[model samples]
Target: QEHGVSGMFTAPTAIRLLMGYGTEPAKPFDLHTLTRVFSAGEVLNPAAWEWMQKQLFHDRVPVVDHMWQTETGGPVFANPYGVSLLPIKPGGAGIPLPGIYAEIRTPEGAALPQGEKGIVVLTRPFPGLTPTIWADPAYIPHRLNGQSLNYQPPP
Candidate 1:
């Protein structure tokens, strides 16, 4: 486009909103400089992924979906497009990044088999994981203890 932006990171809701405008609005700009797109914050629904891949970017760039949290400090699951571009599985957050061990487990901490709903647990820590919240050392443990946790299918 105007700035010759090569990469973009965005939220799924933003993509969905753009989808509502259709493709015509973007026809006037050249998006060739764009190489890839990254989405996080919420589930990147398959419909939005498809529209961005097929209608917006014309399949020229990879649309990657990833997952992380403020507490995690970085992406836990992501398609490592910079390393090896994996096949896009619509609506899925890609595999755990290297050195980050993650599993879907029950509240009791037993690992759950694939396709079973369970809470995502990090079996080991990574450098990027936040060990403590600034000035709130006890917040994480307290909040976790009080919550009745559940899990849904992976985005």
Candidate 2:
């Protein structure tokens, strides 16, 4: 890289778009300075992740997928590349970050097993979670009345 950029954070849609251009367009650039790649906003499909890992970077860097929400403030599930390098799992939004109490549960509040489809719920409030949604005073009571904020993970 001309400017020695070390990392990149992008959306999966951008990666898929770049993938359509193929690997040839990337050959002219020296990307050795890049150390890691991050994806958010949407689920990163295995096919797109594979192309970025094997074809684009040739396994030189880890293409990490993470997920967050505006309500939660920052990333709740991530690879923690800065802490420890975990094994890359294509299409997975890595393990929960430290201090984040997260679990997948059924509609009736029963915890779901691993690999099961359910809503993602935060058992406790974490730092940075907005106490109230701005300009929506009525919605705050409903959200904070022991009601789980349901986030259905992609199938």
Q: How close is candidate 2 to the true structure, as a TM-score?
A: 0.81
Q: Report backbone clashes per prediction.
A: 0, 1
TM-score for each predicted model, relative to the true structure: 0.81, 0.81
lDDT of 1 by residue, 38-77 (tens): 9999889999999999989889999999999888888989
lDDT of each: 0.84, 0.83
lDDT of 2: 0.83
- Candidate 2 lDDT by residue in tens digits, 109-139: 9999998999999886554574443434443
Error of 1 at 28 (Å): 0.5
